[model samples]
Target: MASFHHCIKSGKKGTAANHAAYIARQGKYGQREDLISTGHGNMPAWASDNPALFWKAGDKHERANGAVYREHEIALPAELTHEQRKELVDDLIPAMVGDKPYQYAVHAPRSALEGKTNAHLHVMFSDRMHDGIERSPEQMFSRYNAKHPERGGCRKDSGGKNRLALRDEVIQTRKTCAELQNAALEKAGQTARVDHRTLKEQGIDRTPERHLGPVRIQAMSEDEKASVVEARRDHLHRRAM
Candidate 1:
């Protein structure tokens, strides 16, 4: 079934390096490195080809308590081909990220639920917009200098957004992701469609199912996994009615 799942997360300093390695399927996450397709854009000159270097620098140089990255985890429809999925993400990058430095990867792993293909995209980016400035790695993450722009760090666009604005941005991100997925499905002549609305918003009475993270699913015993599958089956049966 087509699914509409999109979530955003922010990480404090020192997280970007670990996350970049994980998304790139490096280190402990290297088991399925062959199944990963990664790309990066808007990088500064020093780390143009190697985004890991930029992330490592952020971990080392970004201010304490500063958010180093914002990540978007989006589930892609399994009906789309690998190329089609990449194209969908390609379209999203320019719209959402603009001049921000970003790294993204697409992974297709066997679904824990039904052993079918489960494809998804992970995009990690700095909210700091890339200005055409030349600064050392240390200065790049330093406090913004209002008086001398050349001496300051890049500006974080989301820094001053109020709570309502942040909430609206999240809503828009979810809506955009759903629209893109639906468009891709339609282009492929697929009948299955996904909605971004919650069950209550869609006038459905059933409670929404909780999402099990990959790490959590990996840790479950066979019996626990079976219980989850049974619960999912029950949930689907109820949703069908």
Candidate 2:
């Protein structure tokens, strides 16, 4: 099943250029590349052609305490073909990233579990929305000027929201992802579907499975993995009872 995960990174934690390079599997990440398609869009003219230049500028110019980018690490259905998954992602980009300069890549890696594929997409985007005004790299990350918009930095979408509003935004994005995935599955004539809701919300009584991330799963011994599988089977049996 597909899963939704989102996070925002500040300049103090990491630079936007490094994150971009990681997603695109450039530089140091080249050895581990599982890239399918990578691209950038909705950027200022100066950095439109090359996303690296745009992100590098962001790293150099943004304030130390400021958020550099927001990332949505979304799992895609392995049942769908690569092209089908790409189509679904294409539809999603406009909705999630509208008018924001963003970079993204799709990757298909072998799953930790046997006979499965782990296909996913990562989108790294600026919270600042693109306006018509043209600003140099230095001015792009500066404080926004309300009265004279052109002289200021781009307007940010991540700020000014209360905790409740931010929570709602995350829930909405999950719902959107679920909807798109279900539609794609239907189009592909696959019966499998994904849910955005919690188990309680869906009236499921079983204990939710813990997420053992890819690295953890890969590190486990075969015996340990078998034990995990057996445990999950027992859990499911109990749920059925």
Candidate 3:
């Protein structure tokens, strides 16, 4: 139901590090900005939130990051939302974590169907009670690492047969949401915010795979792709040399 991936991105152009640049555009190192929009070479927002929570370097961090991404593919029903998301998450996480501890946050996508399902949870927590003496950042990070070993191991089947299943699930979720909302919309006699069928029509969520079987590989002409050796041989023979 969940997976994680962790990468140590820094303030770099064309990468997520750029996010810090936008937030810290005018300010000195410690000052805050007015309207922060993520930009190139920007400070890591997660770090800004809590310096102790900077991304660790390792495989486990990557998997927890992946678990967060997987939750998006699972697609929360629209009835579930920012407020409700946390409440349910609180309940569901216990099953995931037992009495051990961890910090977790949901990374809601801007749009669930954008293939941009990357908006995800950011959780850095420890199941081990810190003695405050022997524990290292590596030990803290390993708390999640030890708990979730499957991170970044496999991306959700955004390809092949599983791709089709994902499509169907997303579409159905939107439809169910639409039907319920519009029913409530009628109860209030108000206009609808969306058209679920329009989504299906537009191939946004849960549409069937185009399902074109066995892509026929067009053969390149032997004449067109002739190797240098073959071309030279042909040329020499043709010249009667």
Candidate 4:
């Protein structure tokens, strides 16, 4: 499961809007590489101010252990003019899920990624809202937690216990984008239309609150490779789906 969170920047917008900005970045970029100039917020202005502080402020909220001691952000979409997209994302995420429901950060592609101009945002939030009632996000996370997520939706009616709702929410957003894009194309009288389902299948167009489990090792011998790969995929799918 991919994570989604409310990104924030104090003073620019209200708290909730500030918090959810990053997801919009990734949403625009979809799948690509090297989106962030620094690990922090994609501020070219801040880059000159202080390189060290930028990463610290934008340090990887997740991935504190394993191989990465320091946080690194992945690609965000370039389709957004940075300023325009950040504002759009910040407002939308909080407006949808409410702020502080989860941890958030913007992810841009690392330089190693190829042909990627997109800088996307990634977030990890509870499926619960701060609205004092179980929300759609809670319900979606609940389903995943029921089978996985380690603890089963925090084991409380305080939040939802279903997973489909959250997945659908992300999927729907992609759909909305597709529809808008299609309309724009039609307005221009162009034959091109976006195949929106691709995002659903690829999982980028959707938001995932839970952590995707482990991946299997590669480079095994042919005799062992097939079984190992199959097992790995099955395990991940069981948890992720």
lDDT of 4 at 112: 26
Q: Considering lDDT, where higher is better, how would the candidates rank from best to worst?
A: 1, 2, 4, 3
Question: Which structure is stronger by lDDT: 3 or 4?
Answer: 4
Model 3, span 9-32: residue lDDT tens: 212112221222223333343343
- What C-alpha lDDT, on a 0 to 100 scale, does residue 15 get in candidate 1? 91
lDDT of candidate 1 over 1-241, digit per residue (tens): 6667787898899899999988889888898734558899999999898999889889898899999999988888877888888888887776667788999988888887566778888889988777789878888888888789798888788877899998898888788878888888889888767778888887878767778877888898988988977876675455545
lDDT of each: 0.83, 0.79, 0.33, 0.36
Candidate 4 lDDT over 1-241, as tens digits, reads 1112222222111222223333333344445344342222322233334333222333332122211111112222233456654654454444333443333455554322122333454543332222233323223223324455443322322235368875676566555545544454454444444444643575543453233222322333455555644653454455444
* Order of quality (TM-score): 1, 2, 4, 3
Model 2 Cα displacement at 3 (Å)?
Answer: 5.5
**Model 1 clash tally?**
0
How many residue pairs collide in each prediction?
0, 0, 26, 37
Q: What's the CA RMSD for each of the models? A: 2.8, 3.0, 18.9, 15.1
Candidate 2: where are CA atoms >4 Å away?
1-14, 227-241
Instruction: Put down candidate 2 lDDT per residue, 1-241, tens digits, no spaces.
Output: 3343433333432478888999999999999857888999998889989998888888777777777788777788867887899898997777777778899998877768543667788888888887788899889988888899898898888767899998898888878878888899899998667777887897878677788987898899999888977775575455445
After the best TM-score superposition of candidate 4, give how far the Cα of residue 76 lies from its true spot, in angstroms: 4.5
Q: Candidate 3: lDDT over CA atoms?
A: 0.33
Candidate 4's C-alpha lDDT?
Answer: 0.36
By how many angstroms RMSD does model 2 differ from the true structure? 3.0
